[model samples]
Target: MTDIRWTLKSKAETSHVNNLAWDLQVSDEIANLLCQRGIKTFDEARAFFRPNLKDLHNPFLMKDMDSAVARINKAISCGENILVFGDYDVDGTTAVALVSSYLMQFTSNVATYIPDRYVEGYGLSIQGIDFADDNNVSLIIALDCGIKSIEEVAYAARKGIDFIICDHHRPGEQLPEAIAVLDPKRQDCHYPYDELCGCGVGFKLIQALAHGRGQNIEDLLPFLDLVATAIAADIVPVTGENRVLAYFGLEVLNSKPRPGIYALMTFQKKREMTLGDVVFIIAPRINAAGRIRHGQHAVNLLTESDYKNATILAREIEDFNSDRRELDQLIKDEALTQILEKQEEKRFTTVVFNENWHKGVIGIVASRLIETYYRPTLVFTKSGDKLAASARSVKGFDVYNALEACAEYIEQFGGHKYAAGLTLTEAQYPMFKERFEEVVSKTIDPNLLIPEILIDDEIPLSSITPKFYRILKQIAPFGPGNLQPVFISRNVYEIGQAKCVGKDESHLRAVFQQDGSDRFVSIGFGLGKKLDLLANQKRVDIVYSIDENEWNGSVSLQLRIRDIRPSSMG
Candidate 1:
């Protein structure tokens, strides 16, 4: 395993930390965390800890909110058939479900459409638009995609269908000629917060429509479960308006969620769910609907009103998730083996292709490859006559920009700086791969090639009182911008012998303590190879996040050790 670089965040001003700590009656450690999150005052801290729906910005403040709202209302007033079109991913499907369900309150002509991943690829597909035409749809609301479908939007226009696009991806130079193009990332857009996911953008449109209809904000609360899921699944920043949305969304998800969401919860015991649960558990199950079968299943599940029907859909999605897991692991192993056999480990980037690889799982596999190679990765599979790929980037690197640099070889591409998808002809794959590696090698900072575990602070374990942990827990709904804080403790020594655990002995379990601190039990997944370093009572520095463990009717705090290394002093 490659060693992870531990970079501790710089301390906030001492006076600010001390003042906040005194005012909040929290440990300096907690105060510093708040300060790092840009919360230096009592009011800010209160707002951060207690998220409020009222904190959400007025939807009209978006670049094209007025236009988007007017178009939707016009369609509703006319009783025109309206189509809600979206991509076949969690973000897109959730957006479709959210917007389409909201519109159903005003009119019954609303219909939802999710393009097949394999047949339609992504974004506004001709098949989807043709379906709208066949159904006599006069208005189409595109979500999570359509930011770059300039030509496709024209195709819809030629058929007398007006489009209202609610998307979050970076746009191409020319936008689609829609009735309204709502994207915070647009060059001309000046929305106060620009980090909303696709479903969040959909939520804003509904917020505007509701405002125009004089509906109370409470009327929209039920839809937040879907928003929170998208916010988690899309990996957007959990700060500002997004923080408020996610905070309330989590509340709705845990209590009185839509039947579809309720059906997906398979935990043995009911527990207070966190964003982590949404990311690792709920998001994957929802995504499995799209990846293994069809994304329409997810939209159906999210929009289902009956619990029994939702459960049946949820069961089908669960089976899809199982099949997806099998394919993911199998392909990930094969890709890794290819890298070794081809001796491509030393390359600046990883671009592997196989004609038979499943398109649905290549993105997941690309992310898995990064765990070992720690480089920009692209996993390719044959899709029709062309080759399709999913691109994943290392921290601080922009894979999208690199893709742009190699745009000549790409037939189509879209995504954020961290993750993207692209398609190209088979003949162009070699050139694209070579150009991509060349582009990343020359432009990327060498430091980014190594994985970084950014530590929020270096605090002694003694400071980890129950009260401190309580306050820290409030600093969540954690994600990209406001990540769960990681801490580093130095000169820690193992008290009990460390032992490998889990399947294939891939995890390490041990008991450790630092000078003047209580002993902590730690579980380090994927750190089993480092167990030898913990032997012989050698001191070491550890990076970890505090996690709660429950077993045999007992609960205790444990270190979810992220990385371990020998003590620098030793």
Candidate 2:
């Protein structure tokens, strides 16, 4: 068992909730949720629910937007051979597809390039520059990468290739000398929203180019499906401009999906899709190309205009995804065994390695390990002459900072607080692992090691109505920073039936009520073992999210239980 904590929000904000609810003619609970999301006034609430495209800040407001726009247009005017380059991930591949497809509408001189993950590694590579030089490409548009590629950019410049970088990762101390660097995370950049995924940054550059030519924003709405996929896959914050983009992107996906997306949807029985569907279903298929083989297949699938051709590409990617899952599970199981055999379970951090492990799935394995270990984790695999690793951290802890403290043993490292990538000499692995554990143990807050369940509000079972459920879903397109609200119901007791469910009896299905109130049905996935707690207890508190279940042409509210424990009040 693991430690769990419940953090309740302050009730002092209820008065503000009441005022906003009265003004907007909504319930006090809905108003409370709105205020919690920083929507205090009626206007803010309206804007939150109905995001407008005009509300998007002018692309020129981004740093270096003018230069980037001018450079692209000049390339088009001169008919200079332009290459769109990017990393071999979903974000990078989608960014490449977006810009290349958009520019192709204006000029036939455009081409796209994605560096091979094994050949040149990540970001702008000298091999990519050499390829550009040989093709007589005078301009290169690098997306999702090149923010830290000072030497590569300079090398490309010497070869008569100008660089326009559209990246969103945090920048280094000294910027690269490129024709234009358009990253919102630069300390000097004042873009209102800095959490844009790489494709979102690429969209802004194209948006600026369109505006410069006096084109309508509606002309570019078709591309939002790609932007929305990137936003969800990259795990960027779902607030501000991103929320607006995702909101409309879902519409495009549902109403008039691109040929490629439509082809993928044919495999599913569902008629409508959401951001979560894109993340779990579509994003994985795209990412599979990069992980199991090359990302070019993903680009081809995204940009293909013919439904028949896209169907063929989707089949190939499906095979890649199947192979990736097998490898991911195999490596995870091996890593867990290694930890047990080495007796490192008591360590503050998890660091495991195997030279034969596939590098493509290391990041996924790192995340999988965290679900069981619940601490900072790193999974290492042999890459060329060095050992490369992917790092992941639990909530509230900065694995990047821990890596920074142990930078002496690292050859190269880069990424954000929650996730990062690093490489180190084979001889340095032991020292690096030791130092990482020490740093984390000494500096990490003890409470952060335990998992947390944030309860948005405490409500009774009677408060759950069709109207309440309807209003709750309006705040969707949920992700980080705008998570699905988790509500806590106290003094709940089993009413009719409680038993293990599913084939292996790994789930729990029950009916619950409080203070002889209305009965409500709930299903707890993977909570079958908790049946003993309910058998011995009279009352319990449950943390759950309200879900609407539609069965046999009827709709009713269902509680999706997240966790359960004996009632503290009792």
Q: Output the number of the lDDT-best candidate.
A: 1
Which digits, one per residue and each the tens of the lDDT, describe model 1 over residues 440-546?
Answer: 99999999988899999998889887777787788888999999999999899998668999989999999989889999999999889888888853799999999
For each candidate in the order shown, give its overall lDDT on alpha carbons.
0.91, 0.90
The regions of model 1 sitting more than 4 angstroms off are: 267-270
TM-score of each model, paired residue for residue: 0.98, 0.97
lDDT by residue for model 2 (94-173), tens: 89999999999999998888888776777899999999999999999999999999999999989999999999888989
The local lDDT score (0 to 100) that residue 372 gets in candidate 1 is: 87
Which stretch of 10 consecutive residues in model 1 shows the poorest summed lDDT? 264-273
lDDT of 2 at 468: 89
RMSD of each: 1.2, 1.4
